[model samples]
Target: MIVTADGSAREPNFNRHITTPNMRKKSINMMYQWFVVSLVYYGLAMNSANLGTDPYISFAASAIVGIPATLFSAVILKYLGRRLSLSGTMLLAGITCLVTALPWPANLNWVIVTLATIGMFASSGTYGICFLYSGELYLTVVRNIGLGSNSTWARASAILAPYVALLGMYRREYPLLIFGVLAISASIAGLFLPETQDQELPETLEDGENFGKKQRFWTLLPQKPSIDNNSAVEQ
Candidate 1:
């Protein structure tokens, strides 16, 4: 029990514990999302050399794509908002992987490599946007905890990424199929995240509790115009 603002004693709300359902749901969603993102991102890198090109050349190509992807993410984050940018990139990455799943000539290994490279590029963009978006999702007081936990998922996914690529030993397209499905799932999960663009950050636990309470959809719509209080006073 504690004194209230009016000096009345009250029992604390035990329902809002760290293990509350809301908190658990948010944590689990973020964990899965980050896991899939890292899996696809690193899977592409690990499988690049197996696309029939010289190992050095394929690795170089994959590494180089990150440069442009990082540059493009700045523009996307500014104009497109965080949710759309992340979801769209993840979807694009998934699509590229799916394309390679289709049966193609053995000599078309270069095409497969190109598509995989594009997927990696999009995944890199997702990486940049996801970190920014996730940081904004949690309250400032627990920001590090939230991000650190999500990053732990990313590391776990990275550890599994090589095994995902190793599925190529069974079938060349197996890795692509798995990564493609995971990327698509990540994009779908992204759609559920609230848009944080132009919104004030939550500075306290109470402030964060109500964050994302408004479940608005199709965030790309033009924002509603706000009335100017100063203009009303002048009038």
Candidate 2:
């Protein structure tokens, strides 16, 4: 066992981490977010062939969108902060998925493909943000445990993603509808999490518990320095 400088044993207390109300809520929220994001991300890719476009083109479009989506995620995380950026992308993805599942005329197959492409774009961005956001949410003591648990949820969803795509054989809309509902639900769950932008990482369990307790729901953006205050200081 590792001992701290104070000569106390540094064994991680998994029970305390899981049983604490705040940490527990954060874990549940992140689990759902990870599951839904992974499900939608992989589901969209696998369901590409059913988008009524050339399978090759549809697949390529999904793959290529990841570049811009990741860049977009970086911009949003920097400006909008973690909570809003994550939920916003997931919400956008959910809406597009729901629209894509609508029954449109065959002539409007292009519309379906377009919406699906947009969903893919948003899901990819959420996927990138989740990796960073999860780390910030957990205390350093159990950070590895938290991330590993979230990754397990993601992998479980990925395993089921192919089967979700297979639902397309019966009705192409079924898979998309499922993805849409879950993404939206996850977005709502994500909103309960506190914004982590410009905040110090939680280094202890107590720190994690109290991190975002003071934040209101509407506080989604990072706090910027007041230009007037800066000018006054300079003067």
Candidate 3:
């Protein structure tokens, strides 16, 4: 509909015209991104002592795992779609977890440790990008609210991560089991979500909503205003 006084149609796109249902559709998958990203911190808390000997070595060990994985994820995000990148990271991280669980000797511990380090780094980068991905998903009007809520939930997980890790450590096998389950679940969620890689920004809520709802120009454009030739002739 046109604004009667001004006569300008709404800006062309889904972001502005998007519906509540559009927003709700992707909520579950995005939440997984938020929650699972924070799990690495918990993993660190539980697994640090498993590294043995000097505490600095353990700390260094964690950092080592995180750095490369972080870099790999950050660089690949733009190149690959969000779903593929995240799914790959989680799947590999799961493998890394299983590898780390292997009964290797102290001398060969470096190999398993390296895998975990890579997983941490990859997980860190994947988690960090959620802020960017979610921010890009919504329009500017509610952009802050949308992404902020997601980030809040993700970061909020930090408060409970350590406690869970400590509690799980009390039972020895619990933390590993928990991470294993989360890793698998997140990978599945990543696989199911729609790909939004390199798509143009939706200027309004409706534009974002209709992002997948494509149509021809004639379908959206209104009829042009007609000239009153009689009035012109009388003048």
Candidate with better lDDT, 1 vs 3: 1
What tens-digit string does per-residue lDDT give for candidate 3 at 76-136?
7767656667777776666666556556677775675565566566567667567666776
Candidate that would win on TM-score? 2
lDDT of 1 by residue, 1-235 (tens): 9799998999988786443455456667777888888999999899875566577777887899998999999998888888889889999999999997788787887887788789989999989887988888877778799999999999999999999898887787899999999899888888777777777767876666666667566655324345689988998
Q: Cα lDDT for residue 145, model 2?
A: 95
* Candidate 3 structure lDDT: 0.63
| lDDT scores of the candidates, listed in order | 0.82, 0.90, 0.63
Report the error of model 1 at residue 124, Å: 0.7
C-alpha TM-scores of all predictions:
0.86, 0.87, 0.72
Name the TM-score of candidate 2.
0.87
| Candidate 3: regions farther than 4 A off | 1-19, 51-54, 65-67, 102-108, 212-235
